[model samples]
Target chain A: MGLIQRVIEAAGIATIGISIVREYAEQVQPPRTVFLKWPFGHPVGEPHNRAQQRAVVEESLRLLYEIDTPGTIVDLPFAWRRHDYSAWDQPAS
Target chain B: MGISRWKNQLLALLATRFPALAKKFTDSYTPRASTGDIPWVRPAVPLHRAKLALVTTAGIHHPEQQPFDMQDANGDPSYRAVDGDRLFDNFTITHDYYNHSDAGKDPNIIFPLDRLKELVAEGKLGSLAATHYSFMGHIDGQHIDTLIRKTAVEIAEKLRQDQVDIVLLTPG
Candidate 1:
């Protein structure tokens, strides 16, 4: 996403990326990014939550004019409603 | 138990106790590098009037478009052009790395096709670009040059042709 984000921005089009992984987002910083510490494969939110998805999109778009810094990454206020992390059977360390 | 869960727990514990050591340990194996220069573009117009488009790395493609090649272990770096005029009825995912079971049921989770159109209807966004794009995120670094040079150039042209003002990228 970072690579493509850069490409689009370079083409004179603005872009904002919603990232599931903060590590990668920080390294390949795009012009604007929404960092949702939510688990992988669900960047927008859980499967069919329309309200949450719309809120996420609104917040991301809001960053377009709110942020002036080139690589600003604002962490969104959201958490997984489910405690399950997919590897529930794995022994806890 | 798989090694990944254990590793993640150990990393989390180390991060709390020995922060420096934890970072070193994590950084040792996964040396981070920027994919390309981050280019900045100020919005020429207000977002409500700007043309918007969606992009994803979840390997989403139109039902008729050719699916991403997952046979190659190295992965495919190509992207697909998706129509942005309406909500997608169905999308095919060829990415094997991510757990897309739910995405199969509802692609808007990753692509946000429905949400995008909703925003347009609400007049939150000015308009939707004529086209959108998707790519498989599992490609190896060996094709980084091609992806950045060739594929990116191609996608940029499409965005330009559509006069897109803002691109929302959903990285699955």
Candidate 2:
């Protein structure tokens, strides 16, 4: 996924990736990434968790604009199945 | 399912349940270390005014589309172009490398098209590109070259032609 992100970014479009595996993101070093400590196949969040999903999307998009350093991977603060996403608000742009 | 496919599925389930086991699996597969300068680009527009697109490695596709090849030890480098408007109406996930039962129930966990739509409706985002791209994430061996050199490049061109201002990539 990071490799593909690199290609797309090199093509001149900004790219941000949601990575469940931090090692892969570190190795491939895509321009911008948000690392979630969730299980594989659930990078955004758990199934049907609307607030969780929206929060992840909002954070990634926010980082897309905020991350200026290349190869920056922001570790998201949500805990899997533990964090309360109901109060998760969109990050202020 | 073939023997290898079944084995992969079992492994995926175990990995999902055990983070330590997942780390071992990731440690086994070494992605190509990116050299030289890491690619960089700023968003052409702000989030609320930018045309966004999704590019995922979740192995999702329309049911009528051919499933990703599971026979190869090296994963498929091919991509499926998905229509954003109608994707959730009918879709299929073809990845053996992840336990997709959860994703199968609600693909928003991986693709999040519905969540993005809500953002658009709320004026939090500009709009979504009509088309999105999907690929299987477990590419290895010679297929990595194909992905970097051919398929990824092709998708980048397609995104450019679509006038996407930013891309959000998700993985399986």
Candidate 3:
């Protein structure tokens, strides 16, 4: 993802990323990033939680201009609502 | 630091130094990339006025196109273009590494096109590019090189052609 982000950036488009794992994001070092504690495959936020999802996306794009320097990661301390995770609770296929 | 912390650091250093200890680390580890000279071009327009594009490595594709190859031992490095304005309810996930239960429920959990459009409407953003992208994130080894060198460049061209000012990469 970072590789592609850099490619687009080099083409003169600014880029920002939302990362669930700090390790990978730190490795490639995108132009801007928002690190979230969301689970894998849920980078924006939970399904159906429109407000939280929209907020995460908004903040990530906000980082593109808000960041003064390249390769900056805005680590966001976000917590997933502790509901009975329906996905995990699903009957196994 | 505490004595226990010092011991753990020492062990980590030894693992990097000695093959014997490295083999016993018992987890995935990668040497970090040197990014001193990474390319970055800031938008001339503020994010609120710039056209936004969303890209994901979540192995999602429109139901019409072919799915990513889950059987490839080297992993699939291919990418698909998703029509941003089109209804994306039929989009599906095809990767093997990460669990897709939630994404399967609502792909906005991974792709978030709906949320992005809302942002655009609310004036929190400018506009959505006509095209967004999807690639399989589990690509590894030589396949990953192909992804970076070939597909990434190709997509960059598409984004450039679309006049995208900024992109949001959502990785699952």
By DockQ, the best candidate is 2
- Model 1: lDDT equals 0.74
Q: Order of all candidates by DockQ, from best down to worst?
A: 2, 3, 1
* Candidate 3 lDDT tens digits, B1-172: 4564355346544543453654454134342354577777768787568888888988888888898876664668889998877737577777655567677787888898887777677676788898889987756678867877898889989988888888889886
Using TM-score as the measure, the top candidate is: 2
Going through the candidates in order, their DockQ values are 0.36, 0.70, 0.39
Best by lDDT: 2
Per-residue error (Å), model 1, residue B69: 1.6
Clashes of each: 0, 0, 0
| Lowest lDDT 10-residue stretch of candidate 3 chain B | B23-32
Query: What is the interface RMSD, in angstroms, for predicted model 1?
Result: 7.2
Chain A TM-score per model, please list them.
0.82, 0.92, 0.82
Predicted complex 2: DockQ? 0.70
Q: List each model's interface RMSD.
A: 7.2, 2.4, 6.9
The Cα local distance difference test for each model comes to 0.74, 0.92, 0.73
Question: Over the stretch B9-109, how does candidate 1's per-residue lDDT look in tens digits?
Answer: 36544543443553454354331357555688798889779898888888888788887876664567899888765436666776655566677777777
Residue B57, model 3, lDDT: 88
